[model samples]
Target: MAESGQDQTKYLKGPDQIIPSDVLKTWEPMGAVKLKMTKSGVDANPPISVPSLLRRAADKFPDVKALCVKRDGAWKSITYREYFAKVCTLAKAFIKLGLERFHGVCILGFNSPEWFISDLAAIFAGGFACGIYTTNSPEACEHCAISSRAQIFVVENQKQLDKVLEIRERLPDLKAIIQYIGKPTSAGVLSWDDVMALGEKEPEEQLDYRLSCIAANQCCTLIFTSGTTGPPKGVMLSHDNMTWTAHANSVNIDFALGKEVVISFLPLSHVAAQMSDMYMCMYSGVSVYFAQPDALKGSLAATMKEVRPTVLLSVPRVWEKIYEKLMEVGKSTKGMKKSVATWAKSIGSEICERRQKQDFGKPVLYPIANKILFKKIKKALGLDRCKIFISAAAPISNEILRYFHSINVPLTEIYGMSESCGPHTVGVETAFKIGSCGRTPPGFYTKLLDKDKDGNGEICMNGRHISMGYLHMEGETHEAIDDEGWLHTGDIGHLDLDNFLFITGRIKELIVTAGGENVAPVIIEETLKGELPCIGNCMLIGDRRKFLSALLTMKTDMDMDTGEPMGTLQPLALDWCKSVGSQAKTTRDILEGPDEKVMRAIQAGIDRTNSKAISNAQRIQKWQILPKDFSIPGGELGPTMKVKRSFVAEKYSDIIERLYDV
Candidate 1:
């Protein structure tokens, strides 16, 4: 067994070794010195560009498996050399197709090896790649393509091809559409093989020369924001921005070279997945296995079992679902099994608490508990080999975090945005705070703007990882990144004495009551969701209103935990429904009209949440359960499953107004 001390030491670097002396001196005046930065323990260095990293990885680990994807019911792989050759071939093809330096090529797809190849190909061709979410509507897709002025668009399948074709006439700059999976069905639509054939005809010297001339500051990708508040803006990330992120994350996360395995499941369009999985894999020579886009949820367990990945990175929702499943199984056990499970969890929680306090003293039963329970639980979750399990893209519930810790899964939360290349701060196993999102990473400096009484303010970041700016939106770019170089994140947070970051809420999402009280709705909403099993999403609505009200959405047909059909309410939810005098036979039945009993049950949940509120002003007075839950396909939720606040409020204005009508 690995000693806990040694395990922690492998990932944690001393604070003094992270920041360069000259850079520290430069930011000392602005109080940036107080913030924590990742320590590379090396001198200031220029990051290797994306293409260079790919070439180096191929040269270093030529025969090693670099990419894997499921094909025809089997997992197929490509070696580092083969992957590099494919990227080069696509790069040459793009150049042959008249793609000029700094021009844009848009890739619309789910996570796939081909997506990575195309992304790298564009960069290697001395052009930039724009990633559009697969869930984006036709108009949204067209907007991103037009905004980025992409010359070529790559679609995943027939559906995406149709969307692109629907807006084809609107996109005059779009020279061609490349379908990755299926045969070309229409004019102007090309097959993957066609592009490769084109590349085969082009001179290798031309492709190599183009790659060699690529500069660190040159734009490599245009990642569009989720646009929960407004139309999505294309964030222009340079080669320097991406490569620096890869290098910094590699050091910060202790990415083991050649030995680490990663399952690429999240949308590659998101910066988190792109940086952590694709770019980091390239930088560290980690083998990556691609998960099927459609089967991600159902096949995750099978994939995890097969891959046995050493590092796992995911959004909060994935962790929450895992926690729910574990709890469901624990609750289903009986008699001796139940008692043993309960006792094991108790021991695990106690050990976790002790470890958090740096108490290494071993209790008599510690070894026994690990042997009998904790190890088994880790193995069951397919995380026995995982050294680091990260949750990012959005804030996770502290309750979920504690529950995972109790079962021997220590989930670390990281914080960042597209503007900062997906990670600004990250909690390390050695020095993790329960609710804080660690400290700023190396090469970045963070500060707070418009601090409140408690020092909570808009989190601002200035760093090498920060993107150049939004593409073609000069005014918006100026507003986001100031002359001083700080990119205003618009996220409300505060730094602790140790410089650990605690994100509270978004500046735009804050709720203000007519009574002159400012409320951070996220805390209240999270509290309600944590307290109610049936609740899927909770939105606090009372901006300029007399008091706070809420719009609650219930979970759907399937049991959130077990994934079993809730033909009727599940046991716990059934009890609540009975208390409310609800005769609803199914989960859908209750959500349809939500009888008085259901309303009472929901009100009881609200009351419990109110009891935990800091002040009466923050308490939710009245709430109406919505008929359906917010979802990515519904345009009410972002790709990461975060609520699109503006869209939700505007879409349900009538329902929200009725809550406070009295």
Candidate 2:
């Protein structure tokens, strides 16, 4: 023991330690769902929704910590008492603006307390909240605005308002644009203060009037998926459906609660980020920290050092970046550095194997490696005390998972669309399976319907989180939701004996080659993307042509000037991405000189991984590689960074036409 006057301090010397052992340790998987047996079985169907949660938590923990925002390079906190008052204020403002039961109000912005306040406000006013990606293209925004007939548009700043302004005239139902960050500078837009001005001056009585208007089954919000093939349609999520999964994932996992801290990074427009960032944090009375968009890394590191956050929510890309950086470090240093890296890779491989098998954290020989290498990695990312890492929005590579496991962090995979307001199948206290997305949460019924012996079929679910329906699209509503109340996810998946869900592909993205065999491009793309660090993402072409083909997007980590990885193993045939958005075709000619070795490696990874697939659809016979990664800012990926599949398919029509035309 130390002397009485001695100092005791904890250090974030390295990477975070998240125990996934409890979550995935049971070798038995349940095909689609494998929730651990609780004290009494979990309520398989829950009905209490999101607004009720807001109302309840507001009343119960009004004085508790709620939100912390980053401004001036530091954080400022807003207690739950303040949170409740603002939510009531915003809700009252919406009612005063002529919103009524079942009417539509849309919010387009990045992550913030304002987003949630607006949502609660809309729900309390007996209207639905529709959120559009703040990064959406003008056409995409117009389509959603018109279809939802959104009476109010809440925007974040000047850029978002610019987009809404470009096509504001086309959306006749558009009522007003409420700007949050600053005064509305755009013509025809209303400042947040102006809207607040519309609220009754008698604030206390106004809160009562707004609260009196809401009920249980009322439409809470309409979330739009950056749609694949058609106009963006709003998936109508009721308040109850919005809150069910939150409570379920919480109670079932015995979630770490109390005045804890959660770090919010991903765009809140997506559902997964909201589950952990907004819902879970509030329930636990945790202080939620919001990092600014531009200073994510610096702010994240600083915030974590300050907050020692319990949880971090993000998409696969961030994890992928971490892996790439670690690999770069391994490749960069010398002598002892090189030797330790080789040793670490070997040890890490073993760690991943044990992890995938759900028996990780076994006695290890890399105690020194943990002290020197892994700890450094954790400190840089500010994940020193991170309790759990929740990954969603895209399929994360097992390699990244293995990398994190080697360093001690474990990612809990959750599956859902914007329609659910978050997770349906999410990892709780249970350890994880390598490929499966984990078990469905309580209150949801999950099944792989119209599937074959392999259990591959449309992954469908009927749950408390099910959206009311697609707003204003009767045909799409009928198409998505069946009479039985199950939502046809249009995703093909299989269930193992233990109910762990392994999504095989998108049913809608299936390709039929000229040979008449159906192929799932995502299957091949995932396989290749898993191995090729240079490759950001790829799409398989030649759906009905002589042979399979593809267009590969290169990762931004590698330098365009030097074809090398700038760190790890570099790929073949890459440069198309660097030149695509260029004003000149002369610059676009860079793709003509792509590294053949990089191209072959991407092809090799695909062919080798597809050894299990039928030969006719296996290897990509011809390919075109890009020098740039698709991004939401680049008008490629959505705000959630999900591929706008049909948009990409349509945009590259001429290139795709030539591949199939041959």
lDDT (Cα atoms) of all candidates against the true structure: 0.78, 0.65
Look at candidate 2 and tell me the lDDT of residue 160: 86
RMSD of each: 8.3, 12.1
What TM-score should be assigned to candidate 2?
0.83
Where model 2 places Cα greater than 4 Å from the true spot, the runs are: 1-51, 169-175, 186-189, 193-200, 203-207, 295-308, 341-361, 364-369, 557-612, 660-662
Question: How well does candidate 1 match the true structure in TM-score terms?
Answer: 0.90
**Candidate 2 on 216-320: residue-level lDDT in tens?**
344556667766666666766554555656776677556665646777777665666767777776666677877665433324555566777767777776676
Residue-by-residue lDDT tens digits, candidate 1, 1-662: 22212222232221111212221111110111112223554215545578778888999889889999988989899999999999999999998887876677899888888899999999888777888888889999989888877788999999899999999999878887899998987987889999899898888887866765565554678889997768998787867678777888898888888889999988888899899888889888899998767534466877887878888988887887677678667767899978887787788787667766767565678787778777898888788898888899887888888888777777788999998889888887765778889887666788999998999999999877777677767688778887666889989999988788999988788888998888999988889988887676788998999999988766554543433333444444554465567767565687566476777777788899999988989998888777666666566778887888888889999988788777
Please, what is the TM-score per model? Answer: 0.90, 0.83
- lDDT: worst 10-residue window of model 1: 24-33
lDDT (Cα) of model 2: 0.65
